[model samples]
Target: MVWSALGILLSFALVTAVHCIFSIQMPSSLETVNGSCILIPCGFTIPQSLKESLKLPVSGIWRNGSRWFTGSTDIYNSSRKLNEIQGELLGDLLQKNCTSVLYNMGSKYSGTYYFRIETGFKYTFETPVQINVVDILPQPILSHARVSVKESTEVELTCTAPVPCPQQPPNLTWTPELGSITETLQTDETGSYTLSSVLRFVSSRSHHGESIKCLLQTQQHHSVSDHPCAITVLYAPKTQIEVNVSDPLYEGSNVTIFCSADANPEVTQIRWFREWRGNVSEINRTDLTFTMTKDRVGFYYCEAENIYGKQNSSKVSLNITEHSSEDGYDTLREGNSSTVKWLLGCCGAVLMLIILLTITLCFKRSRTRSMQGSNVNKSQIYVNFDKNFSNLQRESRDSECGVYSNVSNSQSKPASEAIYENSSI
Candidate 1:
């Protein structure tokens, strides 16, 4: 049983010694701005045999070459010694944390580097990290929440930049500062820290077609900007109508109307509309200009349309009147005077005819009365003559009778009889 236990322990020790070795876990490549600092995130594992021999006051060293035996090119060291690249070791070496920072870096410090530890012994990691230095910081990447933006809607945009030096992270700024800006730190798939600036605001028509850019400010005060991105906004059209004349529209006069519109993507079609006697109708015109006639006497308006929407202009009214010539006033006055003279002549002729008719009727009435009076006088004279003749005859016969009676009676009547006889003789 004792020999079996010894063989089991030996097998376990061989496996541990073969698998456990000095190793490091960190980023393979990194980039930083000129004259700025760089952050190196590191964690390491020591051999299992050396874990028992670890002691206090551990020393961390970083060299600027692939192999440590090439030369004594130590850029950073935890021991008290002047370093070529100024930096600090933030991680605890006892806890196997080797996170560090390098300051005042330049192109001279750009290369592969290795990490080593010393505690009465020495161990170096086989894996190395590459550092790339640049004169100007790289431009930030800009992304939108949506591809198409609409007017008067809430929108968000993100501007991202790599944080090579987390201690002195780069700041992002937007041109025109259109909205509220907020910043946050995020880790990518490669385990690298990045900074993002989020902008939120409501879009407007005025912002359409405007260019926006994101600028990155590094710790070294170097400013870099991305390409300008234009904003496309979808909105309705604004319409207005213009005319050649402002007032005093006349019949038989030529008038022209113009339609103007301000919109995105341009106006597609324009139409003319008219309202007369409470009825609306469309004029058969599709172009910008419309011709007005005397019969088109009412309210007029125009409609402008595009792919987004349509808009109608304000209503304009027109009143048509008879046209009079300013230069022909004297000729018209002369013509009116002649017409008045002809009318007066006709009225005078009619008055003379009425007076003649009244005079003829008076003469006929006087002649009829005079003829009737003369006839009445002739009839009276005839009646008086017949009566007088009869009386004379009767008196003669009576005288003859009286003479005969006197003669026979022979008295005083004898003289009368004798006179009558003498007359006979």
Candidate 2:
């Protein structure tokens, strides 16, 4: 009896080890993102011989910590939690394989989960699965400079956000239509990202009530956050102001002095003042056209202001000279003399240039002729040497004939006399 019991015990131990080795394996240790779903994939293999004999129910129970409760029986029966876990089970228990998917994962669902399998033979096996839950919140801020600007001017807007490392970054978007959108940028400091978008449009009365918004959407589901900021635009108009008057005004002559200004919104007011005469006048229009006298000659200026800004013209010196008939005639004669002098100077410069060019050409021609003469002299020297060589050749021929005649006379006196007589004849 003792021997039989030992054999049975050894057989049971071996069977248990084999079952454990073939148990289901979950690909990813459980992980969850806030407001997102988590999928737990389980895979297992059964021995071919026992495939038909062994009946493994696909039902599983998830427990947090040491609590052992059935997911289908306990949670499904409870009215409050039934809707939550029932959807997650999704008919995953009936299948032979131990694979499951959880949806609408919440922070409270974060913990360890255990699976329980029941065989037809009253044998039961259990395995543990661990899970981690993370929280990802959207935090975005806007930063920019504050300044006053006139109407129809442009402004800039910037947006920034933070990102967590080892976690997916969120998507950033801008609203209330501004300018072109910029690309996303990452920083060296962990868990941080920044983005800037420009808003360029003419500021007007309509824009005073408008606001710019920056939206951040976290990757964990569609959780979103928004940041909004306001803008104030100021307008003023005042550019340049100036004073002008016609020249030559007699003591009692009707002289007109005008004040003019340039502005975008159009100058609303123009005031004229004389420092020496202490005369002040308010010109409602842009141009101040009035009669002037010798008293209005010392110094004159104008001030211009508008909704945009304000400006003042520089003090202008106005001289009222005595009017005379010779004054007009003398001015014309002086203008004529100045023109004549300018013409004479221009003509003299042209004549000087022509004379210089003529001199340069004449010098180049003389140099070329001198070089030709030198080449001719070298050719003449070669001709003289050829004539001298011909004269020397004639002298040598005469010497050779004298020696031949002397040799013939010495050899035979009669023959020599005959040869000499025949030659002479």
Candidate 3:
């Protein structure tokens, strides 16, 4: 009997040791914005003796103050219908999960609080949780890839806001509506929740030097925004040329040509070219504007270049008219006079070209006909020589064979008569 009593005593001492090792698992401190809600994640383990003797309808209690039951105020109680603070316990105490939540938090609720579990035997956790409440919510963090990128490159930007209360996460939005946006809720190493929004798009030259921002709206309808992020885009130059002239392009008229370019970086160099008589040559002037002389009349264009690339502007025509000393030329020498002279000169040059082409064609045709006639005459002479040679050979053969021919001249006879009369036999 004594051995049995000693064994029971040893078992009781073992149960007490097990209970001393396990207390509670929870964060020591938490923070939240005023007029918002906060969630406290908590769990605890009880001793084997308490678990074996545990009763139904367990109670979870939270007290605010230095002492537990003496001077502390009951903020939340699972057993009672009414409490000081409006909250709900989300975890099941039977399963050792003690997670809870508090709503409509304010500076008055910022203090140390303790948790107690009543399961047949009342036990209070000595570890206390500290709550910090602030009047203003901090701004969300914004991040992105490289600020300066080439055109058509894919870009992604992210905006993250803290989620103090998982049930009520803050809404995130991007400024100017950049592109497709995706949202996700994530957890950090400290077990805090964060809501993030990612914006993705293809960059373009039009988006250069644009300010982008992220806005956040809290559960209490409080709005805040982060600093703007400025982007820089790099692209090739787009060049344009403009001409300034007050009067017609006469022989001594003054003309000014201007060149401009649009690019991410300023244009580093500009070049001018003149095309005349099917030949293109570079002009020595390099400034944005230059004066032209009569000798420079032709098709003019400018090329602008930057670090990325270069571009050429459309060509502009510059026509100069030669001044005539006649009275009529002086009377119509202003605006329409130079244009009329240019058109007349072009028409006369075209007419002269047509006349020269017609003369050349006639000379080639005459030379070709003369060569054909000469060839026909030479062919007839060779045929006559062949006929004469054949007649002489037939006469010599007749004389050697002592045969007399009735035809004296075979060359004068018809082809059929020659064949019959010139026979040797």
User: Looking at model 1, which ten-residue stretch has the lowest summed lDDT?
Assistant: 286-295
Candidate 2 per-residue lDDT, tens place, 1-425, comes to 99999999999989876864545565335555666555555544554454564544434444455335443222221113544454344333334455555555678777766545445422222455676667755446666434345667776666665433213445667667656666456543221234434445667644554666766665544333354666566544333434444455556555445556655456787776666656555445444455666545666667877876777677767676777889889998899999999999999999999999999999999999999999899888877777677656745764777577557655767876867754753
Q: Count of backbone clashes for each model?
A: 0, 7, 0
Superposed on all Cα atoms, the candidates' RMSDs to the truth, in angstroms, are 29.3, 20.5, 21.4
Q: Which stretches of candidate 3 lie above 4 Å from their native place?
A: 1-19, 53-55, 144-146, 219-227, 288-294, 320-425
lDDT of 3 by residue, 62-104 (tens): 8788645788887899888888778888888888888888878
Lowest lDDT 10-residue stretch of candidate 2: 71-80
Q: Per-residue error at 95 for model 1, in Å?
A: 1.7
Residue-by-residue lDDT tens digits, candidate 1, 1-425: 99999999999989897657788889998888789889888998887778865678789998887557676478899985687878899888888888899988898889998998888568888899999988988888888423347678887888888888888887899886889999998876555789999888788888887777788886466464556667788877899987775356666555677789988779998889989999999998764343457667888899999998999999887777655675378678888888989999888999998889888888888898899899989988887787777767756765878677555656655777767855653
Candidate topping lDDT: 3
| Root mean square deviation (Cα) for candidate 2 | 20.5
Between candidates 1 and 3, which one is better according to lDDT? Answer: 3
Instruction: List the global CA lDDT of all models.
Output: 0.81, 0.57, 0.82
